[model samples]
Target: MLAACGSADDSAEQPQNQDGETEQQTADQGGKADQEATFPVTETDAVGNEITLEKQPEKIVSMVPSNTEILFAVGAGKAVVAGSDFDDYPEEAQKLEKIGGQEFNVEKIVGLQPDVVFAHESALGVGEEGLQQLRDAGLTVFVVKNATDFDETYGTIQQIGKLTGYSAEAEEIVSGMQDKVDEIKEKAEAVTDKKKVFVETSPAPDIYTPGSGTFMQQFLDIIHGENVAADQQGWVMMDPEEIVNRNPDVIMVMYDYIDTAVEDVYSREGFDAVTAIKEKAVIQVDENITSRTGPRLAEGLEAVAKAVYPEIFGEAEQDEEDQAA
Candidate 1:
């Protein structure tokens, strides 16, 4: 919203006399040149297109929840005129003009006339046509790749910041996340006894868990916990018998939208012999924070680290209400 405010200050400074007026005029012209030199950004997006923004985007629309979260964290929240239906973080984002989820509303988005539209690569299969429609309507559309790790996520934030004219704020957010991750890594070095961990994404008869090629596995590596599902690849459904045979010392429940998650894990048939069950180490982690790959991911990593080994990483920093729920 304040993207166009930089030029106003120069115009606001009034001169007391003719000599001062000439000096002020020169300073104003210099400032204008500097501003002109900085803008008209042309950069390669996740897709190969060279998207250019002629000036700082005063009105922006984000097509993904993680992108919306980035926009808010980088001080560009006020510029966000609209977002996808799934964008619920930052509270205020819910109040924005909501485009359809999974499938974007091309007409509505084009009608909003956002200076730029932030789309993600992950949505291509479902939204490619909608994106092309927006482009046909002469809208600025940039596709952001879905990040699989912390480093890539940081790069995405920096990219969004640069395009939105919030580069400095984005750097600060990225730096803080890096510092927290480093601290976790450093503290994890103190672990002499690592525990075997199992993370279940969906529970009951159809149990799904992340394995070797996913971000959840990367998080497990950071916290120095052994993933029982490491032998499998990317989000596989493990048989109940197989999970029992693995006998993980810590079981992490990874869904928050459903109730009875912890209880369902505890009461599963033949799970009584499991080490995690016997020791009562079943923990519930918020999927939004842990899986979003946004600004709060490092905090999610810390929370999981703490839950796995409280003695080394301190207590899990869970909200009382969330835990109770």
Candidate 2:
């Protein structure tokens, strides 16, 4: 999956009086004004840089899709001035100024003069100098941490919310996400037969699959499905013959880079012997929802549920009921 997701810290600074007085607000305080903070929010970025925002940023730039999604989710979408080339969510993001793709356009960003720019640790390996250049221009650059699971993602949203002076909205978003997760879990637990799933990021020549230590593995666990690649670590290439031997009950394709991704899988030489292929359980999923670790993670989890357990999550079960009637 091209889903190299990264997020922000949860430790947002609040007002510090001599007495260090603080009080938690109630739900009636408009949304959930959970952790109220003062201006000049100072938090350590992913790269160990102490980035301090003097005030709420009126204009912002996001260098990655996940950060862009986070900013929008926290009610700071209107303040966003520009986003990465890949940002296509919330309809409004598509209309924003386009920064470069993998390689960011520092000149365009500098010209925009955003109050703060959100970067990611995943891009630092190759774009470190580019980020430094932004700093040299006297702009505040905050590198969000790499987030793999739901907890880290929630923290990222809340952190952004505090920095942008939208703490209540951020808390509300996280609360809703948690509620959705609980709802999905309750439904998923009823599944009696656990199925084995195989997910591929790419097709054929260079197939990459996420193994242990990834959010996708946890997603499988939540939906009562077993990952055939749980033994491997991170993204690894698996042999086709070994996949045949394992005989997964469902095959999930996570990329749409090619038009015939699912069809190509069906035509694979030895895949026909696999149980998933025989049962026609090979599925193509929306890579964005499943890969992006942001506000929509719960929705993505639902998508996985629909893909793996169609009889329960999708129209398959409804059709069966109608036929029986």
Candidate 3:
């Protein structure tokens, strides 16, 4: 798992002021509002350098898909003024102004004049310079770390909750998710056999699978399934020979590409003999819920658990029916 190494000072726990906002920590000796501060924001990014918000940010801009979901989930949906192109989950997000994709368009983002800018840690490889420019322009640029496992995902929710004055709400969400996860773990504890699985992503030709340090791997483990490519770190391209050798019992198809596999997968001569293909165990999971590390991840985990142990997840089907009725 991609674990955060920084240790928080236990002695630094401070209470919210009479106004309900905790004193924002600062890095400068003068304690100027213009300077940056490293306040304990959340489990992922902690306002690393010396940037202080003028006030608890009223105009937020989410530059990543997961960040947008987190903002909305934590009662900050009304606060979000801008979003990335992929922020299409909550329907409300689609109504917001879009500022380009992960590659970054500084002008588009800057034009929004956001109070706080939420970027992803993964965006560093592509958008770091643009983020830095935003930072240098005195905009509060907050980076949400891409977690590799469940614990990190929990930490992310907790951190976002604290930052957004939704600590109580965030905790409630985390508690609900944790309880579900615990129940799944308990039920699968006695299963002696664990099957290896491979998750196939969309926009083929450049095929990709989740490796060791990813949120997908965590979902696989929660359902007593092992990622066949866990040894490979990050997203990797797998050869047909590798898949044939590992011989995953299950294959996950992102919902967007379900049509691709139903035709393309079966059409392939050699792939038809694969264990998962032969057994017809290929499953479809919502990409919006599973791919992003947000509140809906619990829902995604349930899907994975269902794929692994259909008998245990029979209630899920009933619950869906009840909801529809």
Whole-model Cα lDDT per candidate? 0.77, 0.76, 0.65
Please report the candidate that would top TM-score against the real structure: 1
For residues 37-149, what per-residue lDDT tens digits would candidate 2 score against the true structure? 46888888888889888877878999888887777766577778898878887666788898877777878888899999998877777777878788899899998887778
Clashes of each: 0, 1, 5
How do the residues 1-325 of candidate 1 rate in per-residue lDDT, one tens digit apiece? 1010001000001111223332123222322222333577887888899999998887898887888878777666777888877777767678889776765677777889999999887777666777877888899999887788999999998888788776665676788788889999999999889899999988778999999988988898998999999999988999999999999999999877679899989999999999999998998877777887678788778878977887897766444244445
Q: In candidate 1, which residue ranges exceed 4 Å CA deviation?
A: 1-37, 317-325
Greater-lDDT candidate between 2 and 3: 2
What is candidate 2's local distance difference test score?
A: 0.76
Query: What TM-score goes with each of the models?
Result: 0.86, 0.85, 0.79
Model 1: ten consecutive residues of lowest lDDT? 2-11
Model 3 misplaced regions, further than 4 Å: 1-47, 202-205, 255-258, 315-325
Model 3 scores worst on lDDT over the 10 consecutive residues at 3-12
Displacement of residue 305 (Cα, Å) in model 1 is 0.6
